[model samples]
Target: MTRHAELVVPGGRYVLRRARIPGCFLHAPSAFGPADADGSFLVDLLIDNGLVADISAAGASMPADGPAIDLAGRQVWSTLLDVHTHLDKGQVIPRAVPDGTLEGGARATIADRQFWTEEDIAARMRFGLQCAYVHGVSMIRTHLDSHEHLAPRSFQVFRAMRDEWAGRIDLQAVGLAPLAVFRTDWGNRLADLVLQSGGVLGGVTDALGVYEGAGDAEMDRLLDAFLMAAAERGLDVDLHVDQTEALDPFALPRIAAAVLRTKFKGRVLCGHCVSLALQPDDVARETIARSVDAGLDFVTLPTPMIYLQDRKPGRTPRWRGVTLAQELLDAGLKVAIGGDNCRDAWFPFGDHDMVDTLHQSVRIFHLDQPFSRALAMAGPMASDIAGAGRHGRIAVGAPADMILLSARTLNEAMCRPQADRIVLRRGKRVMDPLPDYAELDALAGMPA
Candidate 1:
């Protein structure tokens, strides 16, 4: 397959004939149906230059000008998007592993910050991008810890990499500070820095980041200040909200109310919101409704949230720590999933792979009841929320960045880790190898 794909590399057109794609991701109104039980059907994808030129029914003509790679009824998915991550904190394993608690994670990370030189950040960030690309992720939005002193250096490294990796991986960053930072003058400086760097304005409203806990009224005021700060800058807002099990600090509702009252015209996306699920059914429903009215978007980090939530030293976890994804998705709101933390203080087990993230989420959230819709949570849904253009679909005009799996059905694909899957960036197979862990020894506090 590699040699065949390589033969057509230079200014060529080819037909990936008879490939299976989900009907939900196909663009043509013409319909490919008689879909398989997994909701995918066979289609002929015409790849020209670097775009999916056209998609036709199975019997469509294969252009004589180019070679044909018969997919043999294998499944193909759009190259994934991971809308939430902490690339700046990636790959700090032994030195910073969390003790299976939220505050422990925070303390470990805050302690780890003392050693974060620009060289260290760039190394980890670069390694993370390599893992993401080899795993077929073409776009990522990472949260940079922006607490005054760290903001300049972190964004400096990020700006350099965002340019360096262009045309291979689309990169975006958000400034993540605690919500209280907004009330202080330093928060204004951070927001200004985010604007200058072409990054998003972000903060954590969860119990972990806030200083002395406050009641609903104080929170409403703080939330309003944060929303207005972003509004004043004309920047999009991405927040970590309600990530704790404690129901007292529910910023999901306050964020929605603040957006409405302040008329924050920019896009507002709230991640986590785990406490929403623990709220009374009426309260949760009302919050969801208000969030929808305020046009709030959501990105659920199932893997890391599972690890951080419901943890006890001796007892087994009784509840799955996740957002109300099903209810929120059903309500016409844009709900996406993310790889929140990878090999860092927050969670220790990830390779920057969204396919595995989606697969794990299916088992945890039962997202596979309608397979295509669930798949979109990591693909098109995440891309749409991140404003990464149309790269996440199998439509004619979409970029031909795709992952071709050997398996033909969902069960076959999900049953194992797809270490051998082929990644295509702009119609050609990407041949870059994954980075090795030995490269991070110096930063991870390993002995020689």
Candidate 2:
């Protein structure tokens, strides 16, 4: 069949034989081939007309009809989902590299926003999307800076992109602003704009610039108002909460309380929560339990968390920092890991690669004992959090978009970036190379 194991699909239909897939990525792993040591099982995927026709046990039957890509036990993953990212801020490192701290990053970003004309934002964002797609990421939910003046420009660019990247990469936008804004008349307008653009209602509970600690009655009022705004419009909410090393700014529990008290209907997504790791066990447990009771979803940005949470001039960090992902996952809340920022002031690193994001997450969150569940954070779990379409899992009759890895085991896949990995869309090889950073040279330089 077709030159002995080469990736050549005949007429948009073929069989990917001897393909290894992680158990967690499959909807029905029990019915597949026997599991290997790392929980991956071999199976043959029959792709027809851009959809998975069937997944039979490896070598269950002969493919006497058409081309068969003999993968020879290569690992396969469903195209990934990235629930939290900053596309508006992506690729700005050249102009806005921060001092590698949250405050510095925020200040640098605000300074850079003065130059975010629609053309500049669109070019950088389009570049980010191409990078994500080339690396096999199928769905992305990017949080846009939704200040009154910036919202119009950023949301407009995002709306155009959400339509343009419609089929290739399921793009979702979340209007990200500070919690205090929800109490303003402009906040109502912002919510309306988000609704008009089909975007999520999102805010940072404490932007560090405004510390809304627990027991702050004003914080509660603003939060409840924010939730109500989203609820009335049938919109989902995502918030940046507790993104600091200080123990006082405990906004996550407050968020959970607001959600429960308001009985908000829309799905809630909370990001960062880095300070949760610093809380005492009892406090952390109670907060996590409340989150579960409120049915809240979480996204951890480990890459940015570690870089920003513990940084200081002379002293080394007392403890490694990130959100309590392990505990949240154990509590049965939908916890996902995200590439929070890429080549921006936030982290000044990353290439919009969700696979790399997942790889970083496994180490940062200690999710590799199984690695399958960790993979799901960037895959199915992420899709659920973003409310993006269900391309995150490999299922019967699912789109044939997936990544084929030369590594058969999770360890091998994790050892390196898996640079040799091949991305396939609609069961065919994607030949679009990752975008070069030089393409955005015109958009570089600080505003006068």
Candidate 3:
């Protein structure tokens, strides 16, 4: 009693019966539907990772016992993707620090962040990596925080992890430092070290507000130096451009012009452009358009953006706290969704689950209009923006990374996210259920 059997055809018609279970039978499509006379159907129609297949009647010759999952009515979608993230510096819940009125919050964030050690950071990075892989994330761009003296330790460990996981996951590591840190000569030297050590260039800048010894001019100068250094080394840019309501949207244009002037078009990325949320529609739209014109991709950190919104009323229209996602999409600019900080000094709470981030994105932007497009945002679209296309799609030539979701339908999967199995590198299943392609192929050959 096994489900192993092959389908045989007489060029006309045949019946397929359950291998072990005798009651059920495979029925051919009626004279009016889409199934062919031979009962073979397309496994994929658009060559876009759409999993489709044909069915036939179960015949007596089929295996007597076999597992069966009736796919008479089901929907399957391609895996999801998370383009921008900061896993290396994440997983440390920082405590607030003394910074005037917000001193408490700052001190708490820093203290909490300090609790994570090199081993803990590595473990957290691996966990985050696994979580993303399970959720169908084949590639990610994570900025590693290396500002304080502790950076050397974290970067060394994460660098080793990155090397170990290189073939399995496409990981891009960026170097991060606050604006004040970059003002010092040592900061400039460290920035070079990051680039030389296979790190993407750039980090967070305090262009709008200043910490105790930081100034606005220093922030701008730091950004200039960072961009200039990246250009000199032929590296790409990813900056924490704006993260609060205090900054003006004009700052993005300033960066955009500098990018154009430096000729780093299509190489710069700005995450958490939250200031655009506060700017007038016209101004925001124009700034975004110029960013596109200057080749700056935007990655919206929906989770943290929502968390940082002013709780006080009349602060600003229930600030979604996120930048204009739909607007960027409509303007034909590159837009991605990222898990900005997961238990890090900023925000300090996340699970590396990009689907959760997408759920937030879906809700904030009223993305119910066309769900597929929204899902695409969490996947290939973002991958394309971050220059990580090789691992995004599931096409034959593309990387064999994929995740099996628990849901049976596209909408169900998107609405109710679940991770059943995760495969990385080349069809190597890291999580449970494992690779069943042999079983699937054997079943596909069953006689009907």
> Top model by lDDT, which number?
1
Please give me the total number of clashing residue pairs in predicted model 3. Answer: 45
Provide the lowest-lDDT 10-residue window in model 3.
18-27
Ranking by TM-score: 2, 1, 3
Q: Write the per-residue lDDT of candidate 1 for residues 1-448, one digit (tens) a residue.
A: 5432333333368888779997666665247647888888888888988888988777766575657777878788999899999999988887786898888898899899877999989999999999999999999999999988899999999999999899888998999998888779988888889899888999888667774587778777777888777878898989998888988767888889889999889988899889898999999999999989999999999999999899998988888999999999999999998999999988988999999998899988888788777788888788788888875777786778899887778888888777778898888888899999888887745455
Comparing candidate 1 with candidate 2, which one achieves the higher lDDT? 1
Write down the lDDT that model 1 would get. 0.86
- Give the lDDT of residue 46 in candidate 3: 15
Q: Write the per-residue lDDT of candidate 2 for residues 145-256, one digit (tens) a residue.
A: 8889899989889989988998789888899888888768988899999999988998887756354443578788988999989988889998998887778767888999
lDDT of each: 0.86, 0.85, 0.57
Worst 10 residues of 1 by lDDT: 2-11
> TM-score per candidate, in order?
0.95, 0.96, 0.73
At residue 333, give the lDDT of candidate 3. 81
